[model samples]
Target: MNRLDIIQALMGQKNLKNYLEIGVENGHIFFRIKSTFKIAVDPKFIFDATRRFGKSIINPYNLNNQYFEKTSDDFFAQDAQRVFSAKKLQLALIDGMHEYQFALRDVENVLDYMDDNGVIIMHDCNPQTAGAAGCFNDWEVGEWNGDVWRTIIHLRSQRPDLNVFVLDFDQGLGIITKNKPESTLLFSPEQIKELTYNELVQNREQWLNLKSADYFYNYFDLQRP
Candidate 1:
């Protein structure tokens, strides 16, 4: 399943209302989400603002979307309180910088504002190749997953309070929620960074709690479409 399908299913199952999306590049996934209130954060958006507003005015589903043209950090630091004052954050998507530190901070920061039982979906946790998982200096024009998988490892190791796992699809769609984790790792941050892609591949399923696509469908009791 794709991010949108997972998101919409979770929204339906949880009766979620408020939505937050970080790293909204083209509004490809952001605008399509159905929520009572929605927030989008990105330093540089590829979509036209006027078109977004027009779509908002035209469709009830697209309405109430707030866009912040700033880093996720700045959005949380400056504008989070004002918006969250009225609505409790229910679900969020973290697809920003695609690096470990940024992705980790985005999760932590957004968690503070999330309602009970809230969920956060993180993108790029599963880089298909070692080249895709390369660090920023090695960044290329296409298919750079960065080290976001390390964030998952970090959370899985240190934060037992959160349930963390990667659904083995769509470049490793990560699901994070407030619950007891099914598995835990013993790696320190330094050890995680020191880990090689080959090492990760060796213990991929255990390290990431990697579940098959069938697992997701079964977990949610949703049919394949």
Candidate 2:
């Protein structure tokens, strides 16, 4: 199944009333979700925002569905709490800046607002090629996953309290949930940053610890209350 399939499956299992999406280009996956409240953030929205989701079925589900024309950093810094009036986020997709630090920051920001049983999905966690997962400044060059997988590694190693799962599909869709007894990082950024994708490939089990879609499906099914 594709990433959307995984999202839809999870959405079906829970009361994901409050939804937030980062990097909503053309509302491709953003508009597909039927949540009670929705907030999409993207600095450079390519399509026309006002006319895109106009009069759609999902629009009514979230009448207060806001479109923030700003980067995740800006949105978090200035408009995060504003968007989340009182309710903690039940679901959030971190498909924003794919870079390691940026993605890590996105995860950190979401943790502050996420509910105890909330799930955060991050895109591009499993890179097929070294080029895709490698660090690169130029976006015009290759299919750069921008070391987003490192964020997964960071989360797994640093915060053992959080249940982390990498769905081995669609370049790796990461599913994260919070638990108790939060701990400190076992490895440093300097140590993680030193490893190359090739090295990561050699040590995928240690870093990624990915699971199949079926595994995730079962986990979510059993997780429902």
The candidate that wins on TM-score is 1
Number of clashes found in candidate 2: 1
Q: Could you give me the TM-score of model 1 versus the true structure?
A: 0.94
lDDT of 1 by residue, 67-165 (tens): 899999999899999999977799999999988889999999999999977889999898879888978888777789999999999999999899899
lDDT of 1 at 108: 96
lDDT assessment of candidate 2: 0.80
Candidate 1 overall Cα lDDT vs. reference?
0.89
> Which one wins on lDDT?
1
After superposition on all CA atoms, what RMSD does each candidate show versus the true structure?
A: 1.6, 2.9
Q: Write the residue-wise lDDT of candidate 2 on 1-225 in tens digits.
A: 776776776677665668889988877887778876889899887777465657354456645678899989899899898777688898898898898999999999998898888999999998888768766664556676778988988888778779787888888888888864223346677887877878778977556767886787687674522
TM-score of each model, paired residue for residue: 0.94, 0.89
